[model samples]
Target: MDVIERAVSVLMHDGLVVYPTETVYGLGADAFSDEAIQKVYEAKKRPLSMPISIAVSDFEMLCAVAHVRPGMEAFIQAFLPGPVTVILPARNSVPEILTGGTGLIGIRIPSHDLALRLIERFDAPITATSANIHGLKDPQTPDECTVSRELLIDGGRLSGIPSTVVDLVERRIVRRGAEADKVEQFLSTL
Candidate 1:
């Protein structure tokens, strides 16, 4: 089977897998599956309230999980499929656990072919966060991914940076990482 097929199978079975994107290796699972989503949090020892970003293959899928507030469409049209995470109001389609009891969700469409292909096939949001334990440096390569990760999808190498996080709900910059200026410009309109 191809990589996308394998990824869909593993995720469908509620298994967590490490995969590469433009930013870093991410531990991914079906975002809509509470059990699978919990595994991602537990595997990384991430706090339940910390929340995880959801990665999608297209804008339509993105809108399914998040409420596209005014001005969101244009921003997504420009910066998606790149290294940027846009936080938006979570729709009822998203689970409360994924939002940390908040009505917000961070979504992204990474600029990586394999990752995008997996998302397209899965046809559902996948929780995506840097493949690392809490309070550790983000991995820069497949080999550097968190030791606890059992499956690694080596996409050659990664940029060693993470997508810049912009909170659309709050209209502010949450964290400055890779592509800060680009993210800032998107957030500026809010």
Candidate 2:
């Protein structure tokens, strides 16, 4: 089977996978699977209180997991499928573990083709946390990943920066990364 198919299989079974994104490699798990989400935390040695973002295939998939507010569509059109993570109100279907009980969830529609294809085929959002121990450098390639996973979809040397995180609820840029200035400018127009 192809690498993506294997990764999808792992995700379907609530197992972890190490996959490349525009910015870095991510330790991915089914966002709705509590067992899989717990494994992601364990693998990364990440604190449970720190919520991880979820990666979606497209805007439709994003809407399925998040409550898309008015004016938010334009913001998403501006930065998503690129390197920006938007914090949105979570739908009832989202598990508390994925949101750190904050009632808000970060969503990413990555620019990388493999990442998008994987999520599309899986037909579900997957955890988008960096594939390394907490506080360590983000992994750009599969080899750099410190966390063990059932599958690794290596797309080779990802030289992009982390996605700028924008909180739509608060109407602020929570974390600046690749597209902070652009995202700020877009938000100003809203």
Candidate 3:
């Protein structure tokens, strides 16, 4: 089977995966599975209080996990499928582990073809956190990924810049990284 098929199998079995995105490598897991979510936290040695983001394939998938508030769809369309993570109101189905009790979620729709394909094929949300130990550099290549995962889908060297985290509900940038300038420009026009 191809790597993506294998990755999907891994995910189906509650395994973790290291996959490439437009900006950096991401450690993917079944976002809705509490057990799988714990594995991701353990893999990165990340604190449970920190919370993790999630990746979706398209707008419909995104809305399934998050509340697309007023005028938020346009804001999401402006930067998503590129290198930005939009913070949104979480649906009840979203596990509390992902929200850190905040009732908010950071969602991504990666523009990278492989990442997109994997999510589409998996037909479910995957954890979108960087494929690295917490407090370490986000990996730009598979070789640079520091987290433990059952599978790794290499997409060669990435730009190394992480996705910019945005909170449209609050009208602010949470953590600026890739495409901050353009995001700011787009926000200005809003």
Per-model lDDT: 0.84, 0.91, 0.94
C-alpha TM-scores of all predictions: 0.94, 0.97, 0.98
Pairs that collide, model 1: none
What CA RMSD would candidate 2 show?
0.9
Worst 10 residues of 2 by lDDT: 154-163
Q: Pick the candidate with the highest lDDT.
A: 3
Give the C-alpha lDDT of model 2. Answer: 0.91
Order the candidates by lDDT, highest first: 3, 2, 1
Per-candidate alpha-carbon RMSD to the true structure: 1.4, 0.9, 0.8
lDDT of 1 by residue, 1-190 (tens): 8767888889898888788899888888989999998888888898998888899998889988889977778887888888889889999989888889888889999889988988889888888888888778888787777746435688987888888888876777888888798778756765
Ten contiguous residues with the weakest lDDT in model 3: 73-82
lDDT for model 3 comes to: 0.94
Off by over 4 Å in 2: none
